[model samples]
Structures are given as structure tokens and as C-alpha cells.
Target: MDWEVHQNPERLVKTFPFANFREALAFAHRVGELAEAKGHHPRLTVEWGRVTVEWWTHSAGGITEKDREMARLTDLLLG
Candidate 1:
């Protein structure tokens, strides 16, 4: 999945590369839509050519199965 697991906060992070800023922004928007529909949100950083997505459960204070499922769904968004 090419996702990195970070400690302390304990989150799943992944960066998706796009051809340009417009594409990256669109991806971020799509991710936002997904988050809203699922009632779960992630931290998204959209740059000129990439979007970084970080998923974690704040209430649980760490990553959870839902976060992993969301990450998998996020990958499917690119495909």
C-alpha cells in the first residue's frame, strides 16, 4: 500500500502524486467527499503535484480498522 505508519499520534500516511496542481486538488476534493460520506475525516495536504493523506481515529487516539479500510478505499480512488 506504500503507506507509512507514524508513531506518537499513530497514523497511516500516504502521498499520492499527480501531474499538476489541478489534478492534485481534485483528488483532495474527492477524498473530502469520501470522508464526508463515511463520516470520517483525514488530514489532507495538497501540494502542487502531490496530496498527502493521513488517517487516524482521534477518539481512539490512534489508527484503527476503520482507518485501514479508509486507506484501502483511498487507494482505490486512484485506480
Candidate 2:
């Protein structure tokens, strides 16, 4: 719910900050695991102090309710 949802291409995105690269990478791995479990993958950009996640349904040719839910799950992952 704290994520930024975008239109046009239709996607949900969010950036999570961390203390260091290791922390960011660990979060990214958790996101990866979430994606695998739900079969809904996001574009993950991992950086030293941050990780960005963008969710959209490629099969749907845009964003869908599934993507929104996946975005919600991503939040849960962080929690």
C-alpha cells in the first residue's frame, strides 16, 4: 500500500532502503522467493542502499489485479 502505482504501461513500484549492499541483496532474495512462490515476478533493481521493485503482468500485456496483489505481497515480505 505504500508503493507507487503507475499508469500508461500500468505498473506498481516501490524503493526500499537498507543499511548496506548486503541488506539490500538479502531483501532482493526475499523478493525473489516471493515471486517464485506466487509465479508473479517483478523487475528488481538492486543497489547498494536500495532495491526497487516494479510489478506488472507481462502475460496480460499490462497491469492487472494480480499485479496489485503481488505488490501487496511484496509489502508483506518487507514486514
Candidate 3:
């Protein structure tokens, strides 16, 4: 997971694989809940058995430490 940190747009990309669409949506929902709890939301895309999450701090105009935190949280949720 190189996940090269960038300066502009403020986002990091991560992809998760599920056995099926239902599992993917379930994981996405969990991420949404976590985002609400942290007050930091991420953009998500669900396709078939894969879900892609992008985290960015809009106010900072770039990726922040919070983004990585949320990314880890997301991984935990999926796990």
C-alpha cells in the first residue's frame, strides 16, 4: 500500500475487496458511521465486490493526519 501522500485535493486512495456486493455495502455503511462519529467524512465508491475509499480534509485543502487516521479506522471496520 504505497498510498503516496499528495498535497492538493487532500485525499488518499484505498481499496477493499468483499465476497459480494452486499458485504461491500455493509462495509461502506460502517465507514459512513465512523465518519459521522469522527466528524470527518470520506468519498466512497462501491463496485461489485470492491469498495474504494478516498479521504481528504476539505478545509485543509490537502491530506491531513486525520485522513490517515480515518483510513486506518476504515480498515479496522472492514476487518
User: Between 2 and 3, whose TM-score is larger?
Assistant: 2
Tens digits of per-residue lDDT, candidate 2, 8-52, equal 677888999999999999999999999999888899999999999
Model 1, C-alpha of 77: deviation from truth (Å): 0.5
Per-residue lDDT tens digits for candidate 3, residues 23-72, read 99999999999999999998899988999889998888888898888887
Sort by lDDT, best first. 1, 2, 3
**Which one is best on TM-score?**
1
The global C-alpha lDDT for each of the candidates, from Candidate 1 onward, is 0.96, 0.89, 0.85
The TM-scores, one per candidate, come to 0.96, 0.90, 0.87
- Pairs with backbone N, CA or C atoms under 3 Å apart (clashes), candidate 2: none
List, residue by residue over 18-71, the lDDT tens digit for candidate 1: 999999999999999999999999999999999999999999999999999999
Instruction: Judge candidate 1 against the unseen true structure and give its global Cα lDDT, from 0 to 1.
Output: 0.96
